[model samples]
Every structure is written in C-alpha cells, then in structure tokens.
Target: MKGKALFLFWTLLIGFIFSTNGTLVYALESPNTDNYQKDSSYFFIQYNGEEKEVIVNGNITLKLTGWADDSKTTVNGNITSVDSSNSTEDITLKVNEELNELPLNETEIINYRIIVADIFKSEIVTTQELTDSSTIVVQNNNGTSIEEVKTVDEYDTVIENKGLIYYSSGQSGEKLVITKEKYDSLNIVKDTTTIESNAVSEVKATPTTKSIKEVQPLTRFSKSSTPATTTTVANKVPSITYSTHIQKIGWQEAVRDGALSGTEGEAKRLEAIKISLENTPYSGGLTYTTHVQKYGWMSNVPAGSISGTTGEGKRVEAIQIKLTGEMATHYDVYYRVHAQTFGWLGWAKNGESSGTSGLAKRLEAIEIVLVKKGEQAPGSSERRYITPTSVVYTTHVQTYGWLQPVKDGAMSGTSGQAKRLEAIKINLENLPYSGGITYSTHVQSYGWINEVSNGQVSGTSGQAKRLEAIKINLTGDIAKYYDVYYRVHSQTFGWLGWAKNGMKAGTEGLGKRLEAIEIKLVLKGQSVSVSATQAFKEPLKVFLDPGHGGNDPGAVAGGYQEANINLAVANKAKALLVAQGYKVYMSRSDDTYVSLLDRSQKANDLKADLFISIHVNSTGSGTTSANGIESYFYEYNPDYPSKINEDMHNNSDRIKKSVTLTNLIQDNMIQYTGANDRGTDGSAFSVIREAAMPATLIELGFINNTNERQKLVTSSYQQKLAKAISDGVVEYFRIY
Candidate 1:
C-alpha cells in the first residue's frame, strides 16, 4: 500500500458559453487545465472528461467524453449517442427561461452528480455500491437525509467530513449494530455514538489544542500506528484556531496555538466544526469550510465562525482553511486529519481537503501548520510582533576607539573620532521575539551606503572615511508592526531627538560628523514621547505675483490703481502664508515693474510648489456692469504655445493639478468675499502657463465696476481676499 500509485479520478463539469451559430464571438483561455485546447466552436481535450455547452450538435444532450483515450469518462441523462448535425431545439429560449428564475444580480454555479449503471456496451458498478461497501455510520436528527454518492472505490473510499454529531456516554459504552435502512430513518438525539457493522466499527473522536511546533513536511500516506508529522506549508506565516461540534456534547470550546479542540477519550463522533484565527485586527483574517458526513463541504466562513450543521448530527470528515487580507499577504495555513481506518490523510492548503468524505470513520486527530507565502525584499527578514526593548549596537573604530556599549536611545559613534570607524553591528539583545534590524550610514567620502541587516558591518574597513551621518530602520514584518526610534550626535547640533523609520539621524550638507547614535524599538500600542518634525522641514515654497506694478497701472478705473490693490493683497497673503509655515515670495514688493516672463522664471528658480498671479478684471468702461471673481488655470496646447522645452513639458504635466488649485481658490475666494461666483476657468495667461507646479491666475474683481473697485482698495476687503487664498492653499496641501 505504501508504494502503490493513488490514481484519483475527478469529475469536472465545464460549460462553454457561445454566441449564436455555435461560434464563440470572443475566445477565453481555458482554466489552467493543460489537457484541453480551447477554441471558438469545438474544443479538443487532452484528457477524457465531460463538458457542457449551450447546444450540442442538433440534440440538447450533455457531451459525455472528449477525444482523449482515458478510462474516466462523463455521461448525462439516458442519451446513448450524440450527433452535432442533428436537428436541435431552440436552446436559446430554454436557457433564458432557466435564467429568469435566478436573481438578476446573483451569480452561482449549481452542480449535481448522476451514477450510471451502463454505457453503450459496458456495465459498471454505481456510486451507491461504493458507498455501501464503505460501511460508514452517521446519525441524522429530524428528517434530513444525505445526498447520493458519486464514483468511489475501496482504495479511496474514505473522505474527511466537516460536520459534527451529538452523543452521550450511555450510547457509546455499548456497541450496537444499525442497518442502513433503520439508521437512515432513525432520529438520532446525540445519545448513540459507537456502532459496529460486520465490515467496520464506529469510533468517537475528540480534538485537543496544541502549541506551535518547528516547521516540518507532511507524509502523504501513513498507517494509524504512524506518528503525526508536519512541515512548511505556504509562503506567508499565520496562526490558526479550530472548534468542533460533537455528538450529544454539542460544541466544545475553541482551542488554538496547536491545542486540539475535538473529543479525545470520550468516544463520540465529531459533527460540525469551525476554524479561525487568534488575531486578525488588521486583515480579513481566516476563512474555512468543512465536509460533512452526508453534506460534503459546506460554504466558507470567516475566522471564529461555523460552517457545518450542529443539531442535524453529521460527522465532519474533511476541512479546508484559507487566509485573506494582510494575513494572507504574509502567510498561508495548511491542515490534515487522521481517521479511524486511515491513520493520516494527505496535506491540504488554502481551500483543499484532506480526509475522506463518504467514509464514515471518525476523525481521530488533526494537525495544522503555518507556512510563508512569498519572499520579500531585504531577503532574510520576516515579520514578527515587537515589545518595548532596547536595541543595543556597537561600532569598532580604526585606531584608539572601542566605544562603550550603547543601548536604546543612546548614541554609538563619537563626533570627535575625526578618525574613520571600521565596522558596526546591532542586536535586539533584551527583546523577547524572533526579529532583527537594518541600518545604513553616510560616510565622509561615500555619502550614504547600502543598508545592512541584523547586526552586520555597514562601513568600509580599509578605506578611512569618517562616518558623517547615520540612519537606522527596522527590517522584516516588525517594520510595519512596530516603530524603531534613533537619534544622532552631530558635530555642531549636539544630540538630536529620536527619529523613526528611515528618518535621518544626523545633519546633511553641513559636513557634520556623527559622534554617536541611539536606537529603540516600541510596540505599536505603546506610548512614547518624541520630538516632532514638520510635514516639510523648510515650509513648502510659494510664489505670489502681483499682476501689474510701476508704469503699468493694469486696468485702472474709478481712480483705483489695480497694481496697488494687487500689491496690497499679495503682501497681506504673504504675511498670512509666512505665519502659516510657508516660505512665500512676491514678484514685486513695491510698485517696481516686473515682466510676466521674469515673474514666472523667478517662481521656477525658487522651486515653488505653487504660484498665484493676482490681477483685476475689466470689460472696459462701457461694460463696467460685469463684476465677479474668476480663477484661471493654464491649459496646455502644444500648437498654440509654439515653443516647447523640457521645462514646458514638465509644466504641462501639472495641468490637472492647476485645475484643482484654481477651483479651490475660486471657491474659497467667493465664499469669503461674498463676490459673484464667476467659477473656475481655463486660460493661457503668460505667467501661469510658464510657471511650473500648480500655478493659477485669479481675476480678483472688475476694476471698472465702481462698487467692486471701492471694496478691492479697502484694507479690510484686501485682507479677506488674502485670507481666503491662503486657506485654499492650505486645503490643497491637505488633499495632495
């Protein structure tokens, strides 16, 4: 039996959906079944199997077998022969009728099996004969009955059932024999457990919880006397938990961390069962389903939820557990079960089953293992939970320095070491977990080298270059589950506060030598007070251009100078922006004229993230009636601009960003000033079109409109405009 080949035959139902005339308008790749060659009309099969289509030949019969010469074949109904050219019924109408009964939005595949006694000239044993030979006994409460059995043989008669049954001690103390007819009709109330027939004996099963063990591989076929074995499963690692429903005993308590959950010595058959995870706060967690004695496998359920029936009294023979979300992204879970006759079944992962389904022998024992799913970058690193602990590190110097031991929150290098450090290493000496760390350093000559992992040397040995700056970050899953804190002692700035993740520990561009460093790892929920860093250390730069100045009055009317109003508003906005942590620049601080090209070029040189051009709109003296706020963003048109350079192309990339900025500024300005909402528009303004980043031009108001001009010149009104624009900039940063 050990060396014998396990030739398993599977019955797969496939339906081909084609358009009219039996021709597929579009083709699709066949399901990874390499044995089949899919085509538009007729598909060739490499293995003998059954397939269904909307219409077959002229007859509405299910296609029984492919051209492949294999023992396994499929048959549907009593059709003895099929001819593709025969007259066929209008299957389109029939298919539509059947579809009408299904929910419009619901999609499902319904399948059932039929056992045939004879094909053309060959006589065969039906599936019921195989089921009868298996001699498995299961109790059913009320009037529910199990479905008919499919093809099965003596060598593979056993199946892992997932449902549970109830039983009492009195029923198990003595062995009784129940005939198939009587057992099927009897209303089992959990009292009866052990029953014997001439062929096999019914045994009760109990589950127990166990602790996680070292990784191992599974042995496919083993005798009952053989000890249980385990090995690696998938690429991602995860924890598993399971609970069992027993006959008469109802549901036992959930057990995890390798502890068994089913009955052990108290001979009682297992019925329904549920499997889940110990912790899944961040992910979709675990999902699993079980194969019942009669019902086969049920629908999938999430962690801690049940799949099989409890009150109906069925034996759980097999099960499959799958991981999802963040948990699945990191690991996979595999499980197997041992039955009374079958000492140990094969291994199953994700959504695969291990035990015999039709065979009624009780599941005696079970094993589950977590395996990693895929390899991540920074190779040897893996994720693990972290607790509060000090990360100790030490650096070896070139000449006279072997520094004192440094722990978490302490600097390791000496700023005065003007001499080069040869090598450095780190360790989580006091932390109680399976994990490591990654660190990188900036050298006098190298300027930032590749990062090293888990107490490894980072700096060069022979080459003498003083370590100027250093950065340390956690490697593996701990990087996301916890925070690593580090600070550096700089040449001039002294000791800086803690920086987490990949934040720089020492100063750059200042030629500051890193004297020492400190490192610590904190659990996610732990509270740790540290220095705060601005979203942008040097606030985001912004360039404000007042549309006109000096000789150019810019749409002056009603004795109000558009240039002065623009300058006043820009100045107020600059003050407010500076106070709000922004580095603001103006094209003109006074009435000195600045060319449009110069304004845009200045903003580009400053590398501003945003630019705003302020101006007053006028429809001339006769059309002074028009007065409203309108914001314009640059629209990139290659033909109209004529000159296209790399910078212009880069500016073109921000067309969408400019639109967003214009809308925000316009909305905020209108809301604040209570001006007419003229809306955001696209324009080809010289200043905005040339400036990089999200630049926009705002026509504040009609200068010729007497009322609007009066309000625009007032200091209070100008401040309102400035504040509104400033708020819009803040909102833009908040979003992007």
Candidate 2:
C-alpha cells in the first residue's frame, strides 16, 4: 500500500510542473449567442475625400456613415482621410470616426506598412483603399448604345442643312413638329412619374423669344413655367374613353377583381384582378388562355388610387394583368380597384366577356366575370403575384426530414424562415394506392434538425459564431408525398430521416397539427433508451483509459503478468458507473497501444465531464507481493481564481487518501494472495493535470508479490478489483 501511494504522489507532482507550459489553454464552453453582434474596427473617407477611424472595443456597435455629397452620385465609396504622421507605420481607420466609414459592401484592402511582429498577439498600422471616381457606375440604359451625354451643351446644337438659321422644318404656334417616326421610336410608352425619366425634355429651341408669327420654323418643347406664363395649347388631340371593358379577350376565367389590367390611354382601358390563396380553380378544373401586357401608372398615380383615375378626376393610366395556364372552356377571376396608401380607392369593376387580355389579377373578388378560353376579350389587368424562393423534394434513400416545433409558432432561435411547403405530389407508377398525397412542413433553412452537444456546442467547431442548442422540428406527415421522396438530404448528421408515424400520408382532408414539434425517428425495433437515474455531468465530458497495452508484458512472476493485471483493473472501474449511469466514453476496451496523447486527447476532445485513467503497478521481485490504490487531479486556468485550483487539488488528495477504495481492493488481493499494503498517496499525471475538467489516474497495485501476482492474474481477482474501483467513483460523487 505504501509503494502504490508513492507512485501516485510522484505522478501528480510531475503533472503540475508541466502545466505552466501554456498547453492547457481552453475556451469556455457555452451555447451560441442569441443575436449577431458587430465587433470590428473601421475607417472611412468623407465625400470631400478626407479620412477618419474608430475602433469597436466593447460588445457590438453598428458604425453608420456615408459620403457627404447628396447631389453628386459618388456616394458608393469609403469615406476616410489619409494619415501621414507615422513614417514607419500606416494608419488604420476606425468606423466611429465621422470621416472613416467603410463603404457599404466595398472590398477595401487594408495595407500594413510594417510586417507584423507577433502573428497571434500583435498590432500593425494599416491603410485602406477603395474604388472611386463616379463611386457608382452610371450606365446608359437608353437601349440604343448611344453616347449618354449629361451636360446641356454636349448634344444640344444641331447643324442646319443650309445654315437656315433654325433646325426644324416647321412649327405650328409653339409646337415643335418632329418626324412621326422619332416619336414612336423612343417608345416613351409610360404612365409617367415613378422612374423620374427626364422630367425636363432637352430639345433645341431658338435662343431669342419671338411672336408666334415670327418664329415660323423653329420648334421646341415647352420651357420652364412662370406665374404669368401658361403652357402652349394644342388645337387638336385624340379624344378617347373606355369601351366599358377591363379584359379584351378569351382570358377571363382566371381574372381577379379590383386589380388593374390594361394599358394607359387618353381614354385607354387597363386591366386587373384579385384572388385569395385558399380556393383556386387550378388545371383540370376551369382553365383558360389570354394575352399578356404591363400597364403601369405607378410613377404618375398612387399605389392606393383604387380606380384607373386620380383625385382631381384626371384619368391615370391603368395596369395590365397577364396569364399562363391550360386551355379550357371558361375561367373566373376576381378584381378590385387599387389599394391606395391613404386608404381604399374607386369602385371595383368586374368584367365577364369572351375577349379578354391575359393581364389580370387572381379570380376570387367577384368583381370580374370569367372569359371563355379561345375567346378574344379587350381592355384590362396585368401582373404575376405568387413569388417563389426555394424548392426541395425527397428521395427514397434520404438524408434529413421533418424538423420540430410541429406547432406553427413554437420555436425560439431560428436559422432562417423555412420555405413554406406548397404540396408534395406523389405520382406513383406501380405501388399501393397509386394516387396518394402528403403535405410537408419544413422549419429549418438547411432542412436540418441540428442538435448541439455540450463539447461541440462551444466555438471549438467551425461555426462562424457559437450555434444555439435548441433544434427546429418539421411538422406534419411526409410519406406519400410523391412516387418517391428523391431529393431529401440531411443537412445535419446526414441520413437522419423524416417520420410519418410509420404510415404513408394522405391529403384527402389535410391539416397539420399545431402541437407537434418534429417527430423523432427510431430504427426498426430499435429505440433510444435513456435512464433518468443516471447522473449527467452535462457540459462535462470524460474519457476513460483501460491501461496496459497490446504487448507490453508487464510484471511477471510465477505465471503472473502485470499487463493482464492492468486491463482487469481498468475494466472493473468502468463497469461500476456504466451501471450507476455516468455517460462513460471509453478510450480502449481490449488491450491496445493508444498513445498517451491519443488517450489524453479523447478526454480533452470530449472535454469530458471528468477523466479517469487506470493502470496497475509492476515490479521485478523473485518473491513478490504489493498492493494499494491512489488517484490524482489537476487544475490551472490562469483566468480562473487560484482558490478553484486549491480546492480541486485538495479534493483530489482526499480521494487518494480514502481508505474505502484502496482498502477494499487491498483486502481482496491480500486474502487471495498475501502481499504488502502500500498506503495511498497522490501525484498528478500529465493527463490529469492538463485536463480542463477534474481528472484522475490510478495505480491499482504492485505485481511484485509472489502470491499476489498469481492472484492478480485470476479472473476472480480482477472482478473483485473492478468492484473496488467502481465503489470509489460512487463514493466520490456521493461526498462531492
């Protein structure tokens, strides 16, 4: 017993000496942050091209700054001033500095004038550079590849054919007569306003003012208005009005009410429709066809102005409604006047006719009539409403499925909004109930039910930020979704499948349950069995080492060997709690040469709840017998209070000196084969000392005793030995 105690004492002493080597650093394990916190320093240039800088020293701060020129379009570059004081170092910018804001999404390179002296803990001066000039590239979108001239002088002068003093062939009153071809070519087809397209038309005109009779051939657009002056009047203009129709063809079955659906006119008719997502006359129901067009008055009129007219009674341009579906007998879509920002608008117009324009909203408002397929209808609506973001399907051999919080609004931290499921249509070829349908609901962005284990939940893994611990469960039955769920892939551990209560899904009268979290799937006849009685040192991980290796051939005497002795001791210690229920992750079950670090790493990697490494002492004695037990633990996180370390060290020694553990085993060995009792003592092992959690390494007994060596080799001795180690763990937890 005395000898065994000495071994542990030395082991622990050596462990402490090596801990200050700096290899014991570890991160505090915690769940991910609840929200994103910006924490980076920045610099920027102002509109005047000056530099500034600021640093984010605390939690998070959103640095807000922008180029100063409101009228100039150079608003896209970083706004910072240059620093020239330091000759050997370049100055870095801070986001808080008024003149040092980083351009929005700009890739500003930070150039360091001097090389970093310490990569891990060093700071260097840096300069930031970004794109400039126009800041935002201005493109000519006039369609003709013509040089875009912005200044008034660039494209203003026109060389007369004979220097005839004026360019236009003729002018009527104040009207500039241009070739009819030019008017239609510009395709200036618009309701006006929204795009801010050339409010001031730049057409050439005579420099001097003259009476209508004197200015015979010169022509130009109306000039800036003054209080006393009025816009020139036109003698003749097209007089047009609505034909009392919203749609102009065979496309009426799908039109909705109140939605605008036709083009602008002096009296041109625009089209529209409105529908609800609940009920729909889809394909094979009442399908139809129609022509499509976009009629916009948004620039000139308000989004809320109900009718195709304005407040002052001016007839504003009407928008159009378009379509794409099956050819059918008839179609019915609803329509309602535009929804104004201020409130509601004009009367909702409903149209029912053969000739309809393909541009109408949905058909459910009862505001419009259905147009028969193949019938030509004129005058009304245009626009597509249903928008799509992502699409996914499942395969027979799938990866992931239904997540949790089956109930619609139950989850807390969300990765992102899951794409809403439209319908999973399964068209089977030769299967039971060939026409079955299943509705599926997804709750995670990557389609994964990601679970974060304590050890891995910390920043040790590759997550940009620590990920939360909660999981998202997909609700609803997914089976019978299609002939085959062909594209599903588990975004998490992979192959984690979907659940349907082990039955195919049917959509005869489908509605997802609101109480369900995701369904947990189990293997056929296999289930996850958890015991509440088991103690959980959650967030605490531990790795156990069953010592003595593949061919070490430990202490030998009278047909007895220490290698076998070591394995027996290790096995006994493990069984004790696996029974009491400690989550015990083992390093080696059978004899193996797990490197010291490899064994230590498993424990480290697990950041185990605690660690326990076992082994038996050996000695060369012709007539030998010696036995006892001892334990060890280490503590050293500089940031941690020294008191914590002192407490842990004291606790470890108490266990080593405890008589119950060492005595029970010693008695058994002595009874079986008389041997000397080496008293318990403590010494920290490298594994124990470097461990982030509490740890222990035990030396069971010396194999030098003639009778004891013989007994230690026996299976009976090993089991009794195992019981003692197991008892020790129970005692430790009970007391601690």
Candidate 3:
C-alpha cells in the first residue's frame, strides 16, 4: 500500500512538471522499439522569387533576415555562428539516426528548433516530414508572416469636360453665353459677384434680365422660349434637360426640356450623360437606367444624377426609366437616346429608349425624360375602390383555421403562443402587379414543407402541427425590380438567421419551434416602412470545455487517453454548432493543460449562454465494470451572480436550463453510442459550479471498459457522439 501511494505521488509530481514546462512527462512504461538508420531528405529554400534545392543528411544552416523586407540582416553561417544583430544564436535539427531500420509502414518527422534574434529573443520549433523537394519558407520565430503590408487608398472621382461652359447672371433681358467659344469671346469673366474700388468686376445676369440665347444652333436646345424680355412674362414649363458626352463628338447641344437631342441611326456610342429635372411634384419621384458597354443595364438613379461611365471608357448603348409607385399612374415617362449618324429619331415613352440594337453606333448626346400628368382615367362606368399597391396575407393557425386576412407588411402568424400555423394565403385582389408570390415553410417533424405559390396553401390545414419557419420571395416580372428580406422568431435561438431573396432563413434540423416572423420588401436603394410586432428574444452563445489536456491526460486506460478523446469530440461538436450558425468556442484546441478555474472563467468572461465540459469516466484498476454515459450539472443558487443574465435571481431558470441540457446530452449519448444509461445527476464540479451560465459536465463513458474503450477511440463512433451532442444542444436551445 505504501509503495502504491509513493507511485501515485510520483505520477502526480511528473504531471505537474509537464504542465508547468512545455514538455510531456510520460509515467507509463515505454513500448518496445526497433533500431533505425539514417535517411536522406530533400527540401528547397524559398524567399520572394529566389529558390535553391539541396539534400540534407543531419543538419543544415540557413542565412535568414529579421523580416522578408529587411534585406540588411542577410548573412549565411553554420548552426552556432548565425549572423544575428544580437549575440550568437544556435539552431538544432534532430532526427532518428536509424529511421531506415524501422518498419517501412511507419511514419516519422524531423524536429528543428531555432534561437532567433533581431526582433526579439525567442525559440522556434517545428516538425517536418521527409519529402522530395518540399518548399520551406524562412520566417520570423513568432510565426508572423514576413510579407510587407499593403495599404490601399479610398477611390475618388474627378470630372473634367470642355463641353461644360460657365456663365454669370446679369440684368433681365441681358444676353447669356451658352457656348464655350461665345463665353471666351467676351472679356473672360473672372469674378461674377465680387466688386471693389480698383477690381475689374464682371457683370452677372439675374432671372428677369437673363437671355440664354447666345448659344449657337448646335448648343441651343430650346425653340420654345427665345431670349425672353422683361416685358413678356417668361414661360416656365416643367421639364427634364439632359446632355450626353459622345465618344468623338465630345458634347453636342443640350436638348430642350422634353425633347430628343442626339442622333439615332449612327453606329457610335454615348460615353456619358448628365440629367436635370424641374417643376414636377410626383410623389413616386424620377429615376433612370443606363445600358453600359459590357455591363448590361445598371440600376436606376435619382433625377439630376449622372449615368453611364466617363473616364472609365465605357459607352451607353440602351437606356430606360420610369416614374415609380404613385407617380407611375400620375405622369407619362418619356426618353430617347442619341446614335451615330441618325440625329434625334422618335421618342419612346414609359421605360422605352430609342437606340440601335446590333448597330455599333455610339450615342453621342442624349435628351432627358419629360413627365406630364395624364388626364384622370376616364371615369369608370361603375364605381370601384382604388387598388392597393401591395399584397396582404393571413395564416389559418392550428385550432383556428381561416383567420381574417391582414394587410401588407403585417404579421400573419402568432408569436409567444407556441401555437402551430396550419395554412396560409395572400391576396392581390386580382389586381395586376406583374408578379406572383412563392413561399415555403418548415413545419413540426417535417423539415421544409412543400413550397406553395401565389395564394396556395403552404402547410396542411387539418393537421394539428406547428410551423417552425418560413421563406418568401417574388416571381415573374416584378421580381426583376424588387427584393425581400425575412426573419423568424423561434422558441430556441430566437430571431434565427435572416433569409434574403429565396434562401431558407430559419432553423431546419432538430425542429426548432418558431414563434413569430417579420417579412419586408423594398425597391433597390429605398427603405421599406413595414413593421410587424412580435416577442423578441436573443440567440444562444455556447462555450465547450474539452477537459484535461497536455500533461494532465485524464483517465487513461486500454491504450486510450481521456484528454485526446475529449478534445476530438469537443472539436467535432464545435464544428457542428458553427455550421448551424451558433456561436461556439472550445476551452482547448490543442493538447495543452488548462486549470479548471480558467475553463469556467473563460465561459464567464465570454458571457456564454451555455457552458459544457466534456470528459471521460474511468474507474480504478479492476473496477472497469463502472460503465455507461452520465451528465452532471450544478444546482442553481440565487446568491451566485449570473454572468449570462444579470436579472437572473435565485429563480429556477438556471436549474431548469441545466437539467434540460443534461438530460438531452445524456439521452443522446446513450442513443448514439448505445452505451448504458447512467442518467443526469446534480453536482458541484468546479467547471459547472463556478460557471455563471447554465452549465453541464458530461462523462462520455469509461475508458477502462474493454468494449466501450475500443468503440470510444474509433472515428466513426466519435462522429456519431458529436452529432448526438450537437443535436442535444440544438434541442435544448429549441425548448428553452
């Protein structure tokens, strides 16, 4: 008994040393090994664009720099005499001398360490397997990439066109220069409003006296109002004036408001265009589209905006625009484009534009659109209410089929009720909107239910089932101009992933219970004022602790190490959680020792929503009979401060949460691993008791059990266990 106690003490002492120092101190007996022989390996030194190949027998010295960009420290020398800025440094490469004598199927690596200087004092160690002509990049000891950082400046746009002329305001009826040549012909005006005793002040024109008729025939756009005198009231008509910069013509005459200005039949391209609007008060507002050289049609832009590329070198071919929404019915939109030789052909209304199809003619200059309020639709013979611009929807919920329909942007499903949705429908009232609705739902027990289109039923009406999630998108013509963004409020992981366009947005696997949803639609660059009220909730942020690592290998038996198994399973679980978009973190990603306090502290610091410590069970020698999987959790105490929830008092919420998690994991362990059921139990384990959030410690089964130990180490069994744990976590979130 005394000898056994002494042996245990020594084992613990070795473990402590291994933990403090960066090394492994094994207490187990060494396995038998065969003699090995020296082996030759090849490698290439690579830096920037330079490369050198060589064979290494035992050790080789490399000339290196502090950083790849610092060429001042370059020097070559053998191991001990490295030409570093600091004192002499040493590098050593170690390999099994008799590797050739080992079995051919065995794998081995050569280990090397370098005492680096220059940036700081440090040692770098790494292992490399013997390979033929492998490229080795010499880098800093701190593992930072030695490449120089590149900085990019923000982009700025500059405009410089000789076609744009500047003018000044003078007296009413005074002639205004409209062309560059005409402006240059005058005593070039330097300052229009500035005046001083000795300064040569230039006269400017005001609205009443300004006569903008000095422009030549090519630059003069309007034939309507010609050099209006103060005597005659100026005729001001609502209009849109535009000018296009052609490939060769530079800038042609600016088109009169509401008139076509550019050539149409020529095979030239319109390089750039500028538009200006006046006197229209349509609520829908004005926007235009442009077809560029390579990129087809670009999105619409507001009036007085620039379209088509200038210095970018692209040309505008075809174009379209519209007065959207209320303005769509109020005004008729018109536009026309310039072509190579055909000057100002016929005008196109609405979204139409006149331009050559396959002809390579450039659109030199272009005139802008003119919006004219159309006469009210001839009074209908029979009285009818105005049509709505959007569609409304409603869902027939479980136990309550066929609810009243709601308006656009309103909630069609129930929230905080836990009630399931059975069927749903939408209405456009047969009013043409150039599109139809297509939607899919995730229902209880059924992953993603069949998709429904228009006003068709998405889920079964008679079935007493719950609706988990839903996705909605537009189809047909209107879809080309609109986008939808939808989100769901679920029982677990509330307010799950947001789905845009036609992508699935809510939880699918593990059957999360969806409580409410909010759907919205908007035109590009515009805000949707839709609002749907529902109970809001936060998402789960879980932290996984892979217990025991590095020197502190837990419960080793049957040639299996507990720490290794724990890390493997925890990593797998984390991956599964991440794939589902759950925020997750692991206590240890490598074989490194971590204190129990530190593990719990990490969860507290991260304010993790859930904390789970993964470990393996083991009995003393000759006690392998203790098998099966179990989960342990700390009893909730109000006196303890909750890091995840500040409002959490001595309430039973933590206890309930922990127990749910424990039972879920334990049940899944048994179901997936087919191990004996040990059930969930309460405990004050350090990892659980100190955790501020709902926490659980799971013992995945005894490594000492002969049969279970064999199954525990297998990759397939680990993956199954991982999947089960992930499923349990999802279930816990779903319910709580």
RMSD of each: 21.0, 23.6, 27.8
Candidate 3 on 1-736: residue-level lDDT in tens? 4433543454454342221123222231111111111121111111221222111111222323323222212223222222342333332221111111111112222222121111221121111211111011111121211111111001101111112233433466333334434443453435433322111111111224322223121111222334434343234345666766554344445575656555555544576565544543433455677776555677666554446754343557667766665456756666555454344445566676545443333455555555546643222212111122365677877666777777646676677677656666654443323677789887777767778887888776676776766778888755664567667667645665456667665555545655555565555444433333222222458899999998999888977799999999999999998887678988889999999878878888888989999998898674477788889988555555445334432246776788889888888888987888988888757778777778889988889998888888988888988888899898997786
For model 2 the TM-score comes to 0.29
Residues 1-736 of candidate 2 have per-residue lDDT tens digits of 4433433353344332111212221111111112101121111222222221222111111121333343222322222222342112222233111112222112222211111010111122111211111000111122211111111111111111111011122234332333324433554533212323222111122223211122111111222243211222122111111112232221123333333333333222222221222122332222112222223232221111122211011112222322223312234333333221111122222222222122222121123333444544333333212111111222111112223212111221122232222212122122211122223322222221333221121111122111111221222222222112111212221212332332221111112111111223222233233322121112122356776577766556666655566766666656665766556677777766666557766776775655666666665556643455444444334453332234343354534433234444444444543344554444445555454455666665666665555566777777766666566555555554
lDDT of each: 0.57, 0.32, 0.55
Candidate 1's C-alpha runs over 4 A off are 1-537, 642-653
Q: Rank the candidates by lDDT, best first.
A: 1, 3, 2
Q: Which stretches of candidate 2 lie over 4 Å from their true place?
A: 1-384, 387-545, 549-551, 556-560, 580-613, 619-698, 704-736
TM-score of 1: 0.34
How far out, in Å, is residue 71 in model 1?
37
Query: Candidate 1 lDDT, tens digit per residue, 1-736?
Result: 1111110111112233342235322112221211211111112211212333322223233333332322222322222224444532221111100001111112221111222111121111122212111112332232222211221222121212222222211243432333444444465333333432111112222222111111111111111243223332233244576667665455566566456666556555566665656433234566777776556667776554556654333456777777776667767666666554435555566666666544345664566666666632211111111124568888767674566778866766666655445557877664434467888887776778998887788876666666766667876655654688777666545666677777766655445556566677766644465653410023578899998999998887877788999999999999998887778998999999998888888988888889999998998664478989999988766654713224663454588888888898899899999999999877777888788678899999998888898899899999999998899898888877
Candidate 1 achieves a global lDDT of 0.57
**Best model per TM-score:** 1
- lDDT winner, 2 or 3: 3
Clashes of each: 66, 135, 30
Give the range where candidate 1 is weakest over 10 consecutive residues by summed lDDT: 95-104
